[model samples]
Target: MRISTSQFYETSSANYQRNFSNVVKTGQQASDNIRVRTAADDPVGAARLLQLQQQSNLIDQYDGNITNVRNSLGTSESTLNGITNILARVKELTISAGSGGYTDADRKADAQELTQLEEQLYSLMNSRDENGKYLFSGSRGDTPPYVRNADGTYTYQGDQSTLSLQVGDMLTMASNESGYSVFEQALNTSRSQTKLTSPLVDDGRVSLSNGQVSGSTQYNDRFRGGEPYTITFTSSTQFKITDAANNDVTLEATGEGKFDPSKPGGVTFRGVEMALDINLSDADKPNADALIAGHTFSLGSKPDEVSGSRSPGNTSSSQITGASISDSTAYNNAFPGGGAVIKFTSASAYEVYAQPMGPDARPVATGTLTGTPATKAKIAGVDFDFSAPPAAGDQFSVKVDNHQTQNILDTISEFRKALELPVDKDLASRQKYQGALQSAIGNLESGANKVAEAISSIGARGAALDVQADTNESLKMANTKTQSSIRDADPAEVLTRLSLQQTMLQASQLAFTKISSLSLFNRL
Candidate 1:
């Protein structure tokens, strides 16, 4: 297989050019320290790098969000701490004022102090976070949490929806709590009574009769009279009356006026014309006859009597036209006075009276009454009237939400009340309010703690990301080394190859020159 001169020259030139081109390409790649500078260089690795870079950027964004949430939580914690302090001061003032030794002026001073404290607490509850969001407001963080009215009541402005933060891919934690749960629902300070009054009265009496008498005649014929009478009571009070037989007769008041002689009225005496009268009075009064005279009495049946005799039963029933006397006799000894004694039926309904006591006067203090028909007496301000019935347990509760603005005002108002109340009776109330405040504090703390936990989780994730980033950087370096080994050229190796190629190209040119010179044309 003898190679032709033309063929050898052509093949050697091609081989030399190819080797030179390879050396240039490898040298450029080594200088750049990259195997795949573009997608055309290595499509798979370039795409993977792009995806990793995007993940890293997302991690950075998450870190920024976690930082913001952490700052908000910190602000909330600080504000709640301030509120806790104010509540503590209020408790102290309540204890001081409740001692009963404080004069009215002293109490007033205490009240003023409490008012200031309350205002401060309100401000704290309505405080804002670093992001200009209300700390106690649930989801409505931009609005104020409490509002105060001219009537001295507070309204809530926050909503019940909770605020939350995403700390991880699938983890979320609460960032805020509602004002209603912290304030209104947690603070309950009312009580009720147990016993109730019966709806019945006891003392009711009536009598009735009819007859005719001759005024200036020698004689008159006998006649008979028929009468019907009834006395209805206001309530079901129990009472007893003595009949002519000296037997005891018992009676009770019906809610309605239903007179049944077989049930309550006494039997009639025999063989005499008698005057009839009825009396209704309290069973405790000393004078009963003065209460009884000329009052009409209801009778069950008719009676026979002699005419022209002095029959004393015919009279009007509307008015008691007899002389009024404060006599204790002639009526049953149980009558006291012509008055009604009303009683309350339940204790819870009776708390309306007790509530006034907290605001009006201290248990043993001397203060002027503010209501009508006022009588001045050395009376305990805690006295209550049970003349009306109340419902069972006397429990009532109210809840308010969306109170971002009003929460502060309400807290201040309650704190002021706790401070101004009489020290003697307000100890329990103050303690109760303190408990409510503590619960609010706890809610704040819990929210803050959750934020803190999220922050911790974020920090952990950031640290892990940092480690991943470091590992990625190292892997990138290793990949560069592998690429260099696979496709890049070292300067020494490229120089050697270039020299060998130059030598071969020079040899090829010499051979081509000799071959052309030795051709047939040169022989001729």
Candidate 2:
């Protein structure tokens, strides 16, 4: 083939340029230790490398999240430990305050210490994390979990929303626990408060044991939210038991049997059981006969927190304040069907009706509200003070439920109050004090157990986080190895390719120079 001098020079220059470009590109690859500088170099491998890198980055982010969660768990665990210690101390002080040798003055001293411990416990319960978020506040991390009310009772404001953080692909774990689970759900003290209401009979003449709920299912079914049970001995040998509504319950609990009075056995009703004790001897046979004839004793369990709400249809400025279950028996009587609703017939007069109030609903009890700033009244078993005279037709519903869990802080506060009060040297006062102390101790122990469980849960989550972190690290290492194999240039191969390309470029340059000089243009 015939070729012009210009064509020959052009082909030789293009070949030389191509050889020079290869040498420079190989040298850059060796220096950078990268096999594919761009997608054009290795499209499939480059895409694979990108995916691995993204996965690695995601793994790092997940590891960071795990670390944050672990930190939060640690803070909570430490705070719970502090709470456990404070609860132990409070229980010790409560038991010591009940010592027979300790006088009222000693009890007051213990109360002072108890108050300080209570403050400390409150502080710990409202502990904040490193970032100033409340540790046990659940989803409301910025808000305080437990707040002291005006009446010295503590209320939990935080919700039960547990925060979770992702530690791996499609995997999440709880980072916090709600204060409700940790503090508000402690075991309820299972003792009844007994009152001898028969003015004619003295407590000394006939007394009963401190009652307890022996059967939970029975209690729940029959107690009717801690309705008070009244035992009335009709005669020396024959007695009758009645529920809150004045209905006889003798057949359901135990068969009617003659009591010798000298050998009085236990009486079980609803799910509660207590022994009747007669302090009168044979010499006091007349008193014993009188006690059996008309002596009446009422036993009732302390209800959980009482909640009252104004009816939405009511147009009134009046509010129910200091609402409480004053008498369990009456309270149960009030709710024979369901909840109790206080409907105002006039501004001063009101009537309580059984729940599911209808036009034909009958009032269970009727009373008139009259007093100063607050008018105190007892309906059924519920007691409440009215803030202002309600409008005619204004209604309020009161609900008293059976005790399931006791607030830890409230338990502490109640114990403190008991210690602070002055107890007279009387049988009644002594019995009251002992009952209050026993309830406080039971609650404190249960509260401590709850805190311990929370600590254990935190520990378990921390361990799980550790395992997840390790797994992430392993996954990251494996990804890195795959990324390296696809995207990294071998040191020896890059160096060898660079040297060969340089030699080839040099040979091309020398050959092009020799051939160009011998072209027809140079011959001319």
Q: On residues 4-110, what C-alpha lDDT tens digit does candidate 2 reach at each position? A: 88898898889888988888888888888888768999999988888888899899899989988988888888888888888888888988887879888999999
Give the per-residue lDDT digits (tens) of candidate 1, residues 1-524: 97787787787677657766655655565466445567766687667656655655555555555665556656665666666666666656656654646654676687798678767876877888766888766777777877664336655556566776554455454555556455434321111001111112312343322211111121111111211223222222322223334433322122222334324332222211212223345572344434432232332222111001110232211111111223324212322111111111232211212111222532222223222332111112112222222233322111212221123344446545544554445443434434333323333333334434434544554555445455545655665555555444456765666567666666766755666566567667
Candidate number achieving the greatest TM-score relative to the actual structure: 2
Off by over 4 Å in 2: 190-202, 209-278, 281-402, 521-524
For residue 468, what is the lDDT in candidate 1? 49
- All candidates' TM-scores? 0.42, 0.75
lDDT of 1: 0.42
Instruction: Go through the candidates in order and give the C-alpha RMSD of each one to the true structure.
Output: 27.6, 8.0
